[model samples]
Target: MLTKAAFALLLTLTPFFALAEQAIQSQHSCFKGPFETYQGWVMRMASTLKKFDQEVFSAYFPESKFQQVQQTLDCVDFVYQVDGFNVEGYYLKPKLAVDKKLPVVMFNRGGNGRGGYVTFTRKLTFQAELAAQGFIVIGSQYRGASKHIDNNGFDEFGGADVNDVVALMDIIKQIPDVDSENIAMMGWSRGSMQSYLAVKRLPNIKTLIAVAGVSDVHQGMAERPVMEKVYKKRIPDYENNKQQELDKRSVAKWAHELPANMPILLLHGDKDERVNVAHSTRLAGILESLEHPHKLVIYPGDNHGLTKHRQEMISEVVGWLNTYLH
Candidate 1:
């Protein structure tokens, strides 16, 4: 009787397992639309998510906590190697269901140096504000902290930097609940420059927000008396290398090639010291000349970090993203 019962149980389980395998095969068919279509919808989703970042996401949904405040939130960290360098990053999700895919924001950081909270915590002080609001926030540490800088020779916003960012986006799409249609990218300082350059290669970027970005680093540095002095003390051949890399990098000169009518929001402090307000000013000029869709927010008396105006800055960014990505 016991042997007979065991045989019956095995018979009942076999069909269910076969059905599960069939379901998996059906989902993997790769024919058309979202999962089925390779370059079409997949690329489309990537473009949509390219617009969002910490500043905008927090402004839209500012509860502070991932779930209790406003939107659903989850924290995930992953490690990946870019340009032969091991790097790590995190993802922030809103308090929402996986049934309906939500928009995503790519939040990039600035500065060559690392702050204690900046690296280990992965709190995304500014980005958390956005994730609480409603968007998925993704952040990756660009290779090259002071300790690894000289030895790695990693360009803060070089090809490898862009490659890693796009790779992260690719991973985000694999999530069942992420909406491929709504996405954005935003950054400050080095990240700002990274956003400007990465968007050109990524078509899925529905919107872009670059705050105090270095549009033309070579030109920006040469024009700045302080940065120039620092550069001379560091890399004496900065000018020669800068010109050689300009065509491959510099966003200001390549603005015409960027997506037309794609919403772009730029913010900079009038009194920014480290990156200089000119970076935003010059970029705004380029956008105007190209007749692109864009908005420039110049904060009065704000410095590089905009410490006093952070909340206000966050509000403006979230508003811009909602205007476009939503």
Candidate 2:
């Protein structure tokens, strides 16, 4: 008694039902911690060319058709200790194992103090996407994130925060089957500044991905007056010697210090308002002048997070990690 239309509708609904079943069956924590864990299916969303052209594209896009896509991944939360404080972080692994020796990517979060903490949803989506590609992904909540326990109350911008990432390497070493030698890093916004500083300290890192990063602290202070206030508040000697403190954080002033052979991929959105595209462009020029290995890609009409070209940006990141980290 079922018509052809009914049959098609049933077929369309079948996968969702199966997904629901799997969601129930796979509902178990993969990692337990003093940190909370989020493990379940997550909808994967991406923007299209039309959305980008409209200049209305944002990470908060709710109108995109791609939001209907029901791809999901498993996620877990855990904690790693740094400097005698229990720092919160997440460890994500693919549902299916591709290799016993899985590559690792340390995701550096953006913002300062409590502004940049990676939440449960981001751990399940953005971090899980990389994990689904067969890489073990980890991220830090760092020292001063909101609601963080054992707070040391130090927000070093790119200074001690870089050590937090370096300490993660020790955690990575303990992770079973993780290829600690093939480690890579991805940083967005303020996280990019942390990545720049981390690469200098950790020579084991194979490749660097800097997205909407701050390359020049002095330039950033100049571009955004509020940054000057932030610097003065965070850096103790900012009032006495601003340039010296700025120079400590500015990668543009010390491109020569980065590992000469290590490759860096810089991604920026031309329409980025938080951190200007000029940050990446200026660093590209400096790297080129220094003959350091680097690549710079600019997405037109995209914002600080490269929200318009989400899929392309993810693809490029995976490709770069595949080429360099694997």
Candidate 3:
């Protein structure tokens, strides 16, 4: 259940709290002061996504379309704690009847530290897109990682930070409209690893869809040497226990330990330079040998973000979630 503090923080983002910079660290929000209203977040994200689509991804997105999300979604931001460390979270859902509950999707995002943190812009656009599809969507910036909100603790890549993912579950349970029993997880890049670690703890997660995720950090370090730097920096006690540490993040090492009934859908861009496509291909082989129910899709010539196949991924994701989550 949301604490008085948590509930009060939510109040700060409401229309009534729009002008109250005192309600929060005003600079950490979407507008001139702090967090804006849902309508305002939607408008800002629509504009930002449009620019990203135009200059950054016109070629990849097509003549393209930048689907401006309808303002029917209620998107909000709040701070939660993981092991007592303040962590930022994004929550979104359709403006349905209060009694109408919806399946949940915990979207684990890619990138680490300040670079790939889950921002308010993403909550309104990407996560909002999923929420628009009749699901309640939530995600964490993970402790110690944020574009806003200072002193969020440390991100251990997949260490204690996994608690941030788990912490979201507690908050989700407190929400009246959240169908806590019906849940799905989708992770991208580094988030894929986070999802695996989280699913290990969240055995009740119905299913998962990992897009351009990392299955084996062992292979990840080998394929891209730069990842070692990330490991050394983000992963705690790496030098003292490199093998044990990497193994924990690598799903391939213990895929059999996961709930056997939980089907998984793995999507990757074959041409991804960031995280190797082999991670998925090799993991697919392991899942097959174990007779696990999993589907793997490889997008040819697509980048790490699968920029060329964004629409296709959405269709696949929606179908997968509908089939399993329902």
Best by TM-score: 3
Model 1, 222-323: lDDT tens digits are: 666555553443333556775655445578777887878577888888888777788788888888888888889999999988877999999998888778
Q: Evaluate all candidate structures by whole-model CA lDDT and list the values in order.
A: 0.63, 0.72, 0.77
Would you list the rank order by lDDT, best first?
3, 2, 1
Model 2, global lDDT: 0.72
lDDT of 2 by residue, 1-326 (tens): 34667546644532211222211111123322321221111121223123332223233433232222123333544544566665666677654445468899999999887777786546645776788787988877776674646554477677676777887776667555678889998899989888888888888789999999999988887789898777876776668987787898888988899987889999999999899999999999999999999999999999997879988999999999999976
- Scored against the true structure, residue 99 in model 1 reaches a CA lDDT of 59
- Taking all chains together, the TM-score of candidate 1 against the true structure is 0.69
> Model 1 Cα displacement at 325 (Å)?
1.1
Ranking by TM-score: 3, 2, 1
List clashing residue pairs in candidate 2: none
TM-score, predicted candidate 2 vs. hidden true structure: 0.78
Candidate 3 has its poorest 10 consecutive residues by lDDT at 19-28
Candidate 3 displacement at residue 98 in angstroms: 7.8
